[model samples]
Target: MAEAQEDEKVGGFLGWIERTGNKLPDPVVIFFYLALVLIAISVVCALAGLTALHPTQVNADGNPLVVMSQSLLSGENIAKFWVEMTKTFSHFHPLGYVLVVMLGAGVAERSGLFGAAMRAALGNAPKVILTPMVALIAMIANHAADAAYVVMIPLAGIMFHAAGRHPIAGIAAAFAGVSGGFSANILPGQLDVLLFGITEIAVEGSQLDPSWTMNVAGNWWFIFVLTFIYLPVIWYVTDKIIEPRLAKTPFSNTASADESVQDPSAKLSSNEKKGLNRAGLALLLVVGVWLVMTFGPGTPLIDEPACPAAVEAEGQCAAVQRLAPFFKSLVGGFMVLFLGAGWAYGSAVGTVKNHRDLVSMMAEGMRDMGYYLVLAFAAAHFVALFNWSNLGLIFAIHGAAGIEASGLPLPIAMGLIVLLSATLNLFVGSASAKWALLAPVLVPMLMLLGVSPEGATAIYRVGDGATNIITPLMVYFPLVLVFARRWSKDFGLGSLTAMMIPYSVWMLVTGLLLVVLWVFLGLDLGPAAPIAYSLPGN
Candidate 1:
């Protein structure tokens, strides 16, 4: 037994190096290093008189690097520096939005909603389809925020075990969908809308493309195509590659044991049966109401009422326009949706007894997220610091300038941006923050190269999505750590990294190819979305 324990420890350590030796630079150490370097650069640039209010040289290649000095820093611009810093720390819209919804989702999960619903939902699907279907379901559940992380990853083991398949494969498949397939989706999600809004903000900031706009479907057409591409790739990697490697191991878990041991004698009580009916009815009502609200005229579900008189008098476009906020408010919107759903389900299902119970459910939700929220706080602040330093902008500016100098055609340049995103994903993981930092530089740079904002944004999404499965900095990486432990007792961070590295490599290659193909085909990302440069200032 001692020998086995020692073996596990040695194996775990070796595995860690084997997997993460290439990527696990101590972020804490790196943070301080980058901060000092950036401060020095800022100080030197200031001393050298190279500080500009804005980086405004158009068509200039190889702009000389200037060290920033202290005197060049302004008290007025101090506010702007802090604001940019804050944007990094508080950059993730999906993080907050998902957490808010998870509060209610937590309550429902605590109340046995997921297990009950899953049993009912998958009662009849074939075993072969179970793994992929779980992946697909988790993909859909992203609309509910991070419920997939809370519910699906662990449940995959249980569900797969019941079907007499490898539970690890199940977990891998689901994890692949949730994180690996991060950016590709069949439907428009809150992240889609949020990223699009930021992309538009970035394009407008560049002044090279004021007319460029990114709608909700900016990446939809390409993502939808990639969904088919991803499913097969994920399934092949899991079933063919990952499963074979794990089959030699004996780290079986008990999570799936219960799923396979269902007793025929066990049955729902009369009250339980009635509760199920009520829950079903409530779910139907939710779907019905949402449809009505989304489609009905004068319903105010989507947009704010247009005050044409005010617009005409002020000579301002409707800046605070309708329904636009709903898309932006996805987190808050989902919080209410989950809270309402949990309450209704609890009451109808006789699980939630009163208002106290409802509050408890939300509290329970927040409680489950103690670790997650903390990580988010750290991630937010780190991101904020990166932004404040403006290093990301410098990198993007230099990169865009280099791409232009390469004299690459529009299609190749777009593809290169996607590749750049995948490479950048190695260190930075926040999509919005990275895009916010990158877009300001790349958006206008690409416009000058004759790529439209929507096209540039789409390429960015492909790189961002493809790298998610592999990056340790990805917020969900720790969760994937726990998932890996189910299959191998010695599994730790390195094990998870080893398991996912293949998927990341292949997906990065294939995803980039797909993005290039989209550009080649001259695809419309959405209604009024164009693939190439529109008439200047259109």
Candidate 2:
């Protein structure tokens, strides 16, 4: 059968989406265009002396700050720009994250481990349950931080292919749950630490209780509820909408339909089953080693606070901060886990006859990243230049201030916090960094209006998670595109963004409603954390 035109098959709004989206330039070129546009914007703003109050930033005397734009064409910056070109590309976080994960992931793929496991367990995984499972797992994967992007996403795509479905749908499902539902994990994690820590700094001189604590799990119950609400939406979009549209368009990057496995539901061979059993053992061994390393020594895997006396006396942390090192170390943990699992399965099944095969497998994985590396370089430049220009910070401050000036109802104000966070998330990809900027403004302002600081923090979480899937400026955005490209090499940035816009919009609207209702119900955000704020005398 001929490859059908995507726009022709999807009628009405979807067709218009496909048509308009496909008209945009390739992702690489688009980044370059964005860089130029950013430079122009930065220069204009700098000339106009447009500035904003830097919320968390302080000077030598520790007063709040006024941040001005950094003009790209200024003599000082223009010279520094040429000097930092190599450093910009090299320092981009996703560049390193993806490359490192692939070092092991590539081995897993080439060693025939993923294939055999798919044959063994893949055939048994119910197609109907796949979307929900991927969505749920992706949401919880925030515990592993950046590893979700590397491990779960590609694994989702492969599983989809084995199950005879569009692999991009699998990527979308995982991406939605992982990035789009980022704040909705059942487990409270370092994200809780990072954001609440900023919240603490935001309230330093406020009139409320000087000793009021900032709990890491303050939003735990709220986010826990959010996870369930998000799961069904992700399932519906991936299964009901995206995949059906995708089925009409053949994946251009992968093997032809006939050349691909026709009977994806084929039963596993006895040997493959045995290999899977060993793979499970290998995975357990990896986890076991990490556990032993964590508890076997004098808390070697976890970092002990230097000021333990001070920490405990503050009545904070909700628990100890000993897991900081372990949390920080998960990136490496994921690498070793994949490397060990792949090697174990490969050895059990004879795919790896010797150590040389492992070496070759690792190399093959890095080799596949050639296109991704180029894309990352351009994206890094775009992001770095944007950061250097300080437009992102200015834009965020402007957005936050606009909502405050609107004098909307408290519920509406909360919703705008979500919206502002979502919008700024596009420009400044770091969750902690953005929160650091907004917390001082949002948390205090909300408190004066009788919205708990925790409540304000929770609303920010909603906004940050909503639009993550749609933004290319997100450090992980290019990484996700590479995941989609594996199944459809012709899939462009616009294609990914277009497919994701529905998810973003739905998540945003649904999330807004959830926040409004949660506040109305006067639910406890977590232990001792309330939906309302109060002043001492009032």
Q: Each candidate: what lDDT? A: 0.61, 0.72
User: lDDT by residue for model 1 over 417-499, one digit each (tens)?
Assistant: 88888877766676765675566567756665556777777788878877776666677877766665655666655556767
Candidate 2 positional error at 524, Å: 12
**Model 2 Cα lDDT, one tens digit per residue, 1-538:** 1332341244455455445545656567767876788789888999999887765556788886788888999888888778988986776555665566567766666666665553443345678798888788788776555556766677677668767778888889989988999999886654675566556545543323454555666788999999999999999999888998888656753532434333335566666677677778887998898898788867686555633767767864423245545643554666677788778878877888799999998888778778767876776666566566766656646765665677767687778678899887765566755664566456666766677878988999999999888766667877888777667766766687888988899899999999999887879897557878764435
At residue 127, what lDDT does model 2 achieve?
80
Decoy 1 TM-score against native: 0.71
* Candidate closest to the true structure, highest lDDT: 2
- Candidate 2 clashes between residue pairs 3 or more apart in a chain or in different chains: none
TM-score for each predicted model, relative to the true structure = 0.71, 0.63
lDDT score, candidate 2, position 79 = 84
